[model samples]
Target: MTHTWALVNLKPGVGKSTTAVFAAQAAYEEGLKPLLVDADDGRSCLAAYNRADGFKWPVIGLAEPDLHRKLPDLDGGVDLVIIDVPQVEDHARIARGALRYADTWIVPVAPSHYEVDRMFEPPRGAADDSGRYRLLEFFEEVQDMRRSPADVVVSLNRTNRAKRTKTGPDAEVREALEDKGFEVLNTVIPWHDDRFRQAILPRTPGTNMRRLVRELLDRKGATQ
Candidate 1:
């Protein structure tokens, strides 16, 4: 069975594109055919695929608002489809399309108080907004539109594992998200300059990312 996942966030620069690329790489390494779709106008994933020398899976840029309708024609017999969705604050239509199309939604967030606060911030613009654009609230709307509830999980990225003790910021943030009703993935991606902060692909991933992909696959399997 093919799995479709959309990496989303309320704001940009939260490792959505990076997670999408690395997850696809890990899936390929695990002998799965993964199709990466760059639904953000930034096209970061598509650019990374183009710059890399030997990528196992194919990546295409589809930054259209009607992504849900268009992606079915491009499945190409792949085992997985990972979408790098644009931020909901600025690109609600594109984000919603991806949300509607995916069976799983992975939200990558850094371990910090500010990032946690921003997740509930109302989206920019809108004269008479009623907080529908907020990340969690927007997900509620998307859930109503879907035929079945998609598996929504949060991936803790850019973490300082050295400081992630019992009462660390990472732990606090994880607790907060869970309190608000979110399935926080057990895998926490640590901060590594060579692996995460640089251009994606064409390099070996660290153990954390490999574990994250394995956990994601396990979640998908359980739902199936």
Candidate 2:
């Protein structure tokens, strides 16, 4: 994991696992040895590899807090150790442990208040799906309070083409994330059907995601 990177941060459906897994697939195509570590016990990354038969590289699976100690031991053998973390509250402890060790992190934002509200862990009931959708109004609020900022290039995920307006949540979220001092990526991962299919059936990333993965690998010099 010498040239390894971790996709940490305790936020589910934020594309942490999606980014980590696809990044591994992309790195594999480039001939870099990347290890996929499922730092979270649930929806584990290693298990997905076994199921996807997508292990173009080796994978390590561990429960909470183990990754913090395991990272040092595994660092020398691989080009990257990409770990997928769980959402906050559910695995905040594990998330903290992995973040403590991540060299670079890929964070996903959906541009909604519910998604953005992960920053402070809003009053449990105040944040429902509808409340989150209202994030456009509080864009400034999201940018002002980042709990764990890092050498992180935040990427927008699950963006819809037919947005409520025209630019969409992805565009809005990217602006807010950048304003918050994050290094945002240029590639936009458009919502696609096949990518989700590949996720369930176990195959290489489709064309669009593969290209994005290649860019990330190239940026990190993990490319051949």
lDDT of 2 by residue, 1-224 (tens): 25546665445667777777777777777677778878776766765677867665777777567566778787676777777877655775676666666656676765665665564343345655434332222222322333433346666666664232236566676666666566766765666656653565434545545666666666666533
State the lDDT at 8 in candidate 2.
Answer: 50
Badly placed stretches (over 4 Å) of model 1 are 123-133, 162-165, 204-206
Error of 2 at 163 (Å): 14
In model 2, which regions exceed 4 Å deviation?
Answer: 111-114, 118-150, 161-166, 197-206, 218-224
lDDT of 1 by residue, 1-224 (tens): 88999999999999998888888888888888999999999988878887785488888889988888999888869999999999998999999999999999999999998998778676456433453336877899999999999999999999879334467888999998888788899888888778755754544345677788888888878767
Q: Against the true structure, candidate 1 has what lDDT?
A: 0.85
TM-score of 2: 0.72
Task: Extract clashing residue pairs from model 1.
Answer: none
Q: lDDT values of the candidates?
A: 0.85, 0.61
